[model samples]
Target: MHAEGADAADDARAALLAATGAATLDDAVIIARGRPRLDGGEPAGPVWKVRSTRGLDQEVSRLAKSRGVSKSQILREAAAAYVEAS
Candidate 1:
């Protein structure tokens, strides 16, 4: 009876792994966030969050749309520009 229970538990575990698309416990544990890199390079560094007014948020969105880039890209370029100006 003990051996039968162990086999049933093993079967349940295999079914769970199949359902979650993870082959092992380690594969099921990892959590990755953010956009994946297209260059096959390392992921981006730490994230920076900023609070913005509604007007400023709209302006940044407009600028980003005009330049065909993401708001994050715009922010990065703006930071570089500030460093250069300083």
Candidate 2:
């Protein structure tokens, strides 16, 4: 590779190493949970994606099934509860 290409590859490797200090996905989640809010300030609008693992998805599905509610309803209620609490 060219000298600039080599340097870019090294930088990318260093960034990935820094990002994955924890060895497991669960550890990464814990690290992520500890991070400060990334919004910089209050968000400008309401629409956003909420991320979760398969484990959480299964639990939410179970709750929805038992409660006779749709998955959307469960997710919406969860988001509403979080918004109200914060």
Candidate 3:
């Protein structure tokens, strides 16, 4: 079992090195450690939850689809613009 785990780790490290063009195992490890958590371990940044009408949600979704971006991206851009204009 330990050998299997080690092999999996080795495979992941090799794949990471290849994908990132890292020259060393240390570099690959650093890159892996730098990735943000997506499993609810810890957030990479501030997260906000807002309440909106269904119409607003649909509009945001429509805008996101038309702009070829995620709904979150649309909301983030809108927030940034509001801040800049303030």
Best by TM-score: 1
Tens digit of lDDT per residue, candidate 1, span 1-86?
A: 59999999889777655654455744433311233463488766778999999998889988765554467877888888999999
**Which prediction has the highest lDDT against the true structure?**
3
Off by over 4 Å in 3: 1-43
Q: What is the Cα-based TM-score of model 3? A: 0.49
- What local distance difference test score does each model get? 0.67, 0.65, 0.74
**Of 1 and 2, which scores higher on lDDT?**
1
C-alpha lDDT of candidate 3 relative to the true structure: 0.74
Quote each prediction's TM-score.
0.51, 0.42, 0.49
Ten-residue stretch with the least lDDT total in model 3: 30-39
Worst 10 residues of 1 by lDDT: 27-36
Tens digit of per-residue lDDT, candidate 3, span 1-86? 59999999889888987865566877656644654454578656688899999999999988765554557778888998999999
**RMSD values, in order shown:** 12.1, 12.8, 10.4
Residue ranges of candidate 2 with Cα displaced over 4 Å: 1-49
User: For model 1, what is the error of residue 57's alpha carbon versus the real structure, in angstroms, after optimal superposition?
Assistant: 0.6
Q: Which ten contiguous residues of candidate 2 have the minimum total lDDT?
A: 29-38
Q: Model 2 lDDT vs. the true structure?
A: 0.65
